[model samples]
Structures are given as structure tokens and as C-alpha cells.
Target: MAISFAQCFLAVDDHDKALAFYRDALGLEVRNDVEFEGMRWVAVGAPSQPDVEIVLEPPGAGPGASPADRRAMAELLAKGLLHGVNFWTDDCDADFERVRARGGEVLQEPVDQPYGVRDCAFRDPSGNMVRFVQPRGR
Candidate 1:
């Protein structure tokens, strides 16, 4: 048996702004954009990892969610309480500089972690904490 990740989701309040960060800043390729049932989902992925995708979706996009649930989710997303994604890069400092130059909100500069990786963090347009990591000694 074999299992692998295909998609993971992040909640965003604005699709265009998220696209600017993920696609333009982080350099992920846009895989799909679709609207259905009054909700929109945009898929983005690293070019080298074509089998994996991150879906940028509106808060509370799940079915059977109540209005109150949606509101709560929106509030959480606004507060940066939603879970974010981490990406692996070959060059952490270079990727950090590129994303910073492209206007991603810097959460932390590149630093070597005690856990054997060098990483940096940035806030996506919707306040999700995106991180880039490179294994040390690479």
C-alpha cells in the first residue's frame, strides 16, 4: 500500500491577494481555479512537486457549515489562527530574500534551527504563517 499527500488547504479571505503571495511571491504555479456553489477554490503547487497541491479556499468552505460557523472561521482566519503550510527549499536565504523582495510580510528572517534545518517565515496576505525550510548542511 502506498499513500501520499495530494492536497492540503489554507483558509483565505481574499483569493487575489493570496494568489499574489503564493503564486507571485513564493513562485508556486497556479494549478486550478474554480468556483462552485458560490465558493471559490484556487489550487497552487510547486513546479517540481506536481503531484502535491495546496488549495487556497474561503473560510468555512466545507459543506453543511452554518452561517455562525462561517463567521467564526472568518474571525479566526483574520486573527491568523488558521493552520498554514510549510515548504521545502534548496536555498532558504535566497528564497527568503526573493519572497521578501516580492512583498511577503516577514514573520522571521532566516535562522538555523536547533532541529537540523534552516528556515524562515512570512505571513501570507491573509495572515497565515508560511514557512520555508532547508535541511542544514545541504
Candidate 2:
């Protein structure tokens, strides 16, 4: 009953590029980076979720992922079939601008979403959408 979900993993085609997006664009900290058995591994953590990490794994890195699966995932990413990762920030405008300044493509300008959140959206290097939001008037 005390189990905890420590992290969520996303399969990317390029680890270094993903790291650059997460670290430079999203402003996440790279907690760990390493390689094993011809595979590279990296993790990023939010400032508040210091203990929780998001694993950025390359396609076909897992046993269940085959060459075809990797190709399929790459195609899907290119077509923007993946859902974005949403993050809460204290300054959505600041974060959005920072991301754009870093050569990150912002899919949406900062605006008040219908859910009462002021947000902006962008895509990572691998075509994964990521949203940064802040509470209105905060």
C-alpha cells in the first residue's frame, strides 16, 4: 500500500537531443546520465520533484521494443501522434520565452486555457509535446 510511482519514461530517438530540450528548454535538472550495454540512459527531474525522475530512453532500448517498433515510434513522433507532458510553473510566460529563446518551437502562445490555467505548449526535439502552465493571477 506504500508503493509509489517514482517516474515516467518516454522513448526517444536521440538521448542527447532530448536532454538538451529538457534541460535547456524545460529547465529541468539532469539528475543522472550514463550508458550500459551499448545503450545510453538519462534522467531529468523537476525542481520540486527532486526525488522523482523522468527516464528518457531511446526506442528499442527495452527487450519488448524491436527494430520495427522503433521505426513505428519514430514515425509516430514525426507525425505528432504523441501526447504532451504538462508541467506546472510559477511563470508560464518566462518559461515559454526561455524555451523559445533556446530554439525550442512553441506550439502555443501563453494564454488562459479553458481549465483556468495560463499555459503555453511546445514540442521537444523528438516531437513530443510539452506544456508549461501557471495559475492565473499568481
Candidate 3:
């Protein structure tokens, strides 16, 4: 049997704003957007990676979390303390320019890392750091 990544999540304060950045700016496609169990369930994925999806959810959305916990989580999110995921792109510089042109907050410009990848970073509207990386020589 082979194991593979299926889904990961990012805490989003507003679903629509997240979509505008992920879909409109980052060029991810919305795979699912529906309401379930009194909550909105939204998922987005890179078109090239159908099996990998990122779920956009509210802070402390787990069933066991209390109101205070949710508020704390929200505060952390607003403070840019929550970790977001990194994405691999075929063209890091092009993607970086696109995101920047669309008004994404630049955290870092593209640079070749010692690890042998060219990468850049931006902060989403909700303050989550989103990174794009490309292997050197392509």
C-alpha cells in the first residue's frame, strides 16, 4: 500500500476573502463549497494536483473547541502565528509576480535557497504565510 497526502487545512477568518486570494490570485480551483452541519465546508486545490486539497475553515472549528478557545485561535491567526502550507510551482518567479500583481502582501521575493529550490512567500489577507517554491533549473 502507498500513502499519499489527501487534504490539509488553513484557518480562514472569511471564506470569501480566502477564496479571492486562493482562487483569483493564486489560481487554485475550488473543489468543494457547501454548507454542512451548520458550517461552510470549502476546499481548494491546484488544478494540476487533483488529489491534494486544502480545506479553508474557521479557527478552532473542531467540535470539541469552546468559544474561548476559538477566540484564542482567531487571535493567533490574526497575529500571523498560525502556520500555513507551502506550494510547489513550475515557475516560482512568474507565480510570485502574479500574486504580487494581484495585491498579495509580499513577505519575501524569490530567491534561490541553499536547499536547491527557488522560493518566495506572501501573506494572505488573513495573515497566513503562503509560500511558493520551484526546484532550481526550471
Best by TM-score: 1
Model 2 scores a TM of 0.89
> What would the per-residue lDDT of candidate 3 be over residues 23-91, giving only the tens digit for each residue?
999999999998877677699998999999999998888999999999999999999999687998889
Which portions of model 2 miss their true places by more than 4 Å? none
- Evaluation by lDDT, superior candidate among 1 and 3: 1
- Tens digits of per-residue lDDT, candidate 1, 42-118, equal 99999999999999999999997899999999999999999889989889999999999999889999999999999
Worst 10 residues of 2 by lDDT: 77-86
Over the stretch 40-122, how does candidate 2's per-residue lDDT look in tens digits?
A: 77989888888788888776577788889878877887777854688888899998888899999879999998888999998
Model 1, position 16, has a per-residue lDDT of 96
TM-score-based ranking = 1, 3, 2
- Model 2, position 128: C-alpha lDDT score: 82
Given candidate 3, what's the lDDT at residue 47? 90
Off by over 4 Å in 1: none
Model 3, runs deviating above 4 Å: none
Please list the C-alpha lDDT of all candidates, in the order they appear.
0.94, 0.83, 0.93
